[model samples]
Target: MGKLQQFLTGLAACFGAILMGSLNVWPSYTLELYTDNTTTLLTAPMSEFESSLVGSLPSLGAMLGTGITGVIIDFFGRKRGAMLLILPIILCWIIIEFSSSSIPILIARFMGGVGGGANLVYAPIYISEMAEPSIRGSLASGTVSLYCLGALLSYLSGWFLSYGMIIWVNLSLCIAALVLLSIVVESPMFLLRQKNEQEALKALAHYRTGSTGSKSVLEELSLMKQQLLPPVELVSVNADAEANEEATEKEKLNTDEVVVVVPPKSSSLKLLLCACGGCVRTGANRRAAFTSNASCRAFLVVGTALTLQVMMGMIAVQVYAGTLFKQAAPDLSAHFCSALFALVLLAGGTVTGIVADKAGRRVLVISSSALVALCMGALGFLMQSGVAPAWVSAVVILVYCFCFNFGAGSVPYVLLAEVFTSEVQGIASMILVEWVWLLNFVLIAVFPFMKSLMGVHGAFYVFACVAVANTILSYINIPETKGLSNKQIQEVLHPKVDKQNSIDASLSVCQKAVFQEP
Candidate 1:
């Protein structure tokens, strides 16, 4: 068995995500600095719009960063693209340290958001590519778990440290992460797709070699190469020409002659793109690598599942957990409840890291989402009824925190990395990840108003409804990806052909067939 060397560098790169998660709740932590005259850091306390903008701008910056991530990562390479962000992150801290008013802080947070947004895109994508399928989901889920660790640390600092102190501490962590990131090797898969086979093999061997000998590393590399080039069925190929090519080519051939075409024999970057199904769609011929119908279904499953997870109010919980706790139990300290909420988030994420690969993705998502809905519904009823004990709200909310973080909360991030083929993974991740930021901004912007109008109970009721919808959607649409290779995932998504669940069969296309050279 290979030790998890890939996980260390990937996790180091992901340390920047802690910056994103911490900055998200930055406004909430610093709200009192403006509201309290004694601690006032500003000349004049901000108006609601300014306060909200402080929170919203980071999200907007995140959206901007995510929109361009595909271009930057693909063009500059992942490690280089990530290194370029250190300057902005360092700059964001400098601006915040000198901030005497809302404007400087606003600019700082937005710049920080750019780094935060890119963190989500690169961390998960990098890890998924680094690990083998048997351990891939678990390692990728660690990103989300470590994000919770960042949140917990932020909450701790908020309780005892000043806002300036918090900014300086985060800056130090980013610096340390940069030093660690310097040692990271470029992704082998990325090297392979760029047609740098020798470098790709070297990187792959570095990650894959441990107690295992050189032979196992070579086998893993070959397997990865095979997955990079999937086979297209005869029926799928002929579907593009609508029988026109079949008849025209038939005239030049006899019935005994079989026109066999496979993907290119050379390890060209173009062939890698064709294998991904994304760039394949760019041709005049409409048949994608996995075929069009399968592509559509996979898209819908990922898009709808991730969108629903946000609609269920996970962002609101993360952003406003302290405020919501104040409403739920007036006797308890808001900061204490916030600490507990984050603690549960960390614990739940730890559990996900352990269980994700063992249990299927579909069951975890459906079951956890449903459980969250029930807990939220019960909490709303308890609050509305005016009879529950203060301790009950804490108990109810802690359970909700755990459930939400486990699957409904983290699976979307995992699936976003998993669902798309390599050809479109960059662009697809940009869109989906940005969508997360967009939803976070909208939900946080409206949350105070929603709470004022309906009270906390009413808002919880709305969240519970969305959670219910998420559970049903997961049951109906999401496929289990535990222990399955990308080829297996493609097979599950594309069921139009009489395909079997053989990883070797799907990967053996090039070895089995011949391409008609142009």
Candidate 2:
């Protein structure tokens, strides 16, 4: 029952993910419709430049949406903020359904991008908060799996349904998603942060499928409080010490026993740095988490993973699936082949979600990334030689999709939500996701130019190289985070200094002191 309730909430989040996935591939199938001269749906056939705008504009809008996620999620609360975020998607479809020209549809796509970008952060955060640690990886990755489901559905819909019908279908799904989100309770952690203890307990109980007074529910709530709140006694002690120290400093100044000197340039620089770090938090816990060396290292890992994830060419393939298929297999139906690609994504993501807890994040990512590199390298050879059978190229592409999703598609997101404490999760996620959207915009916008300049084989070669590098990095850097609590993960990231290193440092200090005294 506890798992059921959590699944239901995750299912709500999945609905939004589905919309994002569909939007991602919408241009893949619809670009032809707008660009075809015989089509009556547009004022005129879209120019090459206009078509690229249609395909890439959402990513730019996503950047804007991701940048503002901390503000929206923090201000509105996760549940309500997600519900409010759905409004833009709904509005996006409405504009598309009514508009006859490219400009309004472009505007609508940007709005949809905003909703999609926010979901990239919101769904992972919401699911991670509501799920038990045992099942967190599955629920989190399930969202990505479902995003593939959305893309698969969109491919089929675009193949079979009319443009107007596709618009209405998405609109209906948006309404259904909003309804599901309403049924779920607010995130228990969000409530705890807001200091609504009673409500937090109730929310936790709802998710746990137990009464607030139950031992399991109470214990879990207590654990969340411990993780999120600073120790009150420690805070008070620090406050009193600071007060006494300030008084002593004032006395010294009055007696002329000490002189204070401030450098304006250094003071201004220090203030700027502090203000930059402080933007994420005002509380002690959040400030420490945001400014910690451990968090910075984790961010570096996530950032590099995210860069590799984008550079590996999945976004380009997803956005241009039909075109790629048409090029590779002129005899096969491109639409069917594109749907096949999405199906592979769905299968790989679902399998990853099911086994992530058992196999662990590091192993899955390292092994699958190696396979991705192999398949991509094979595809490049097939494309460059022009001698391989059409089926060989198609098979290699499908295999690449499956291998990419097996780990790369979903694991980094799990890491993003897992590595940070709740204090800095919102801001950290925003910054990382914003980076992703910016990459999406640049890659998607330039992919056509790249294909024209370097040829498809060249692009595949570039992606293969990136996948190889990613595999190496994941093997060396990614920690095994399976079944560990957030605190345990943090300890792994920021372990205690070795006793031998500590002793050697002490001896070195003593030696320095002796030499200086002489």
Candidate 3:
């Protein structure tokens, strides 16, 4: 296969993964409403605790699901792990659609949450591994786009159908997803790492050549052999070291000129600090500092961006949109208005992916923050005046969603995944995703009370402040990650600072004496 073919196959696989993964989040928007309404219609009276429990159970389940699945992605391999999740998701959908009681519904949603959480970890890792270097940003951005699509689908379903119908529709989507999964190939990296050389070669050939003759297959195999060589040598060294130091030395010698040198225990802490510090420093601390610094900064920026964006966009809007809409247009249906809010969110997420790679994450985030703040400020003013038209209110809300997704929503996951080394990619992505879910939980829980106490307009003004803060932080603290290699991103995020003079000034007599000895 040519480069374009390889890219297209990878892109197809990524799109599929995201589509299935996002299927998990689509039900969240309407699940609470559905649960509450269904319970009230069926039972005599539902308590506040029961209502809250039905609404919040899925999120609690999702937190546990993601935490457990995050640690297992690297072990099970991304493709197999993802495939395993489909069964539970499908089963959950079936139970939710057919089961009678609220308890069954909660269990079903919890099972679905497990699938959703696993998808959050697995889809990005699979996409990042499969994607070509040049188009990786675009591909990574697709994951968020698909997630938004899921949200949109949920909103549309709620707008058009009853609760039972929504459940059936989701069930159908999951069934179709399972059928599609059977055709997709496993990740070549997983096979290679497992020492299934023949299978790995076959998979790579399929990825690279589509279908070719023996000579071409042999050529591809040769290239894979060379590419797989470093890991093989490293594995041998590790295995031999477990046997004895002398065996390790012999194995290292056998690996031609490549030497596997293990540093002393005393150097480990410096290595850790340097790795965690930033990416630009060189010498012994360079590799450690580079990976550590890059991953940490990326996590901080991406996690903060996701948390703030979702808090402002989904949490704030869900809590206050009804009051604000009523104040702006007493005649319009609040349910329809909420559905419109969801549509704008979908539009923002979908469109942002189209331009994110070209515009760059830092620029997109900063610009989006400014736009969101503007729209939010306008929303506050218009709500306070009580004179804004329904159409005007709708436009402002749509524009707010657009700006939020166009900037922060599309960029966070892409930047986080791209800014880390391959060795820690799974764990690093998990950390950021876990933070996103946690912040989402906090925002969802607190926004209603905040809105009640502060009023609709006041709540939005608070979100606007957050946007401005995010913009300033992006400008001062976050570096651009677009089109940069993981190592290069690490370097950019942690530019070198001259600390030698400060060190000299702060040194104590004993430290100075130690420095003199060095």
Candidate 4:
């Protein structure tokens, strides 16, 4: 029952992703329709500038969406924030359905992009927070699969459906997604942070499918509380220790014996210094994630992975797949080949989600990155040599898509979902996702220039090099978070000192300070 509930929650979260996917691909097929005078969809056939805006407006809106979404999710809570995002997408379809002019349609596309951009940030965070550790990766990876499914739906819809019909279909999808999102439970961690312990427990049990009083659910809730709310007594102890010196000076003038306030039952100042130097902390007992050394390091690691994910040319490749297919196989229809491309992407994503937990993140990312490099290298070599048949380049491109999706395509999102402390995950996701959207805009814009300057083969070589770099980085920096709780993962990020040793050392220092000869 817990598994069923979790599955439903993940599916609900992915509706945003589905909407985003369809938005991304909508321009691909509709651009020609809007520009052709024969089509009755627009008041006038769009000029070159207007048509470009129709296609590019969404990216700009996505940039705006990424900027504000972090605050929304944190303030409104993930479930409500996700549902709220769907409104813009619904409005997008409605505007398109009623408007005959290109300006309104262009505005609609931008609104759709806003929703899509928010999805990239919110869906992963919600799924990661709600899922049990054992299946967290699998559930998080579902976003990619469902996004591809949406893209595939758009491709088919554009090929067969009329303009008005496509609008109706997508609007219906957005409405349904909103309805489904309404029923899923709020994130247990968010509930705990609100100090709603009983509600948090029930939410966790619903997702975990355990009794509220069950040991597993209770233990998990306790860990969450430890992370969310530190002990108030420890803060008071620190306060007392600071005032001890003033008290001692006053007592020295008034009494024969100077009373000393013993330190709290934790580690000494020296141990704290050592842990700080080592960048280790025990659970969420640390400072804000942005201020903490451990979290900063984790951010660097995730930032590098995301940079590499974009540099590997996944977006550029997808955008240009039809061109590549047409060059290599003139016999095959480009639209049909594009549908195949979307299907292959869906297949790779599905496989990753199923195997993510069993295979572990590090292994999948490392191995798949290496394979992506190999395929890109071979594709570039074949295209350059001109000795291989045209079909060989086509086959290599398809294989590259599969290999890329197997790891480079999806795992960074999984890592993004899990790496940061909850304190900073929202803002961190916004920053990193904004970076991704910016890169998507930059890469897609510059790719044609790159192909012209370096030639298509040269661009492939560049992508190959990026894949190799990512492979090395992932192996060296990324920790295996599979089946690890948040506390355990943080401990991995910042190794804690031995509790007994820290206590004994702290005690000895306190004794010496209090009893020394004067």
lDDT of 3: 0.61
Query: Would you list the rank order by TM-score, best first?
Result: 4, 2, 1, 3
**For every model in order, what is the number of clashing pairs?**
0, 0, 6, 0
- What is the lDDT of every predicted structure here? 0.72, 0.78, 0.61, 0.79
Q: What is the lDDT for 289 in model 1?
A: 34
- Residue range with the least summed lDDT across 10 consecutive positions in model 1: 233-242
lDDT score at residue 231, model 1, on the 0-100 scale: 51
Per-residue lDDT, model 2, residue 312, is: 94
Which tens-of-lDDT digit does each residue in 1-518 have in candidate 2?
88898888888876788988898789988998899999788988888888888877778878888877678888899888998888888999999888888899989999998888788888888887888777788887877898899989999999999888998889988999899989889999999989999999999998886898999899989899987744221010111223454563343324422222221222212222333444213322222222333565567788889889999999877665566677778888877887888899999999888999899999888888888889888888888897877677777878888999989878998788688767667777888899888887789779899889998888888888999999999988888888888778777876354556434333333322222322
Model 1 agreement with the true structure over 23-136: per-residue lDDT tens digits: 776666787676665645787787777777787787788888887776777777777777776557778889888877878878988898887778888876777677677777
The window of 10 residues in a row where model 3 has the poorest summed lDDT is 230-239
lDDT per residue as tens, model 3, 1-518: 44554445444334433434344444445445545655443443345565456556656666776677655655676665666666666777788667656677668767777666666666677666555445667767766666666656666676677877876777776666555555556666667667886777666666654554467656655644543342211112222234554564455335443333222222323433455554334434322322335545555666677676676655557555666567667787756666666667667766666676677778888898888889888988877786867558757877887788777767776775576555556666666677777887888778778768987778888888888887887787767776765456767765455676322222221222222322
lDDT of 4 by residue, 79-180 (tens): 898888889989998998898898898899999899888887887778778888888898888888888999889988888898778888998899889889
Instruction: List TM-scores for all candidates, in order.
Output: 0.84, 0.84, 0.76, 0.86
What is the alpha-carbon lDDT for the whole of candidate 1? 0.72
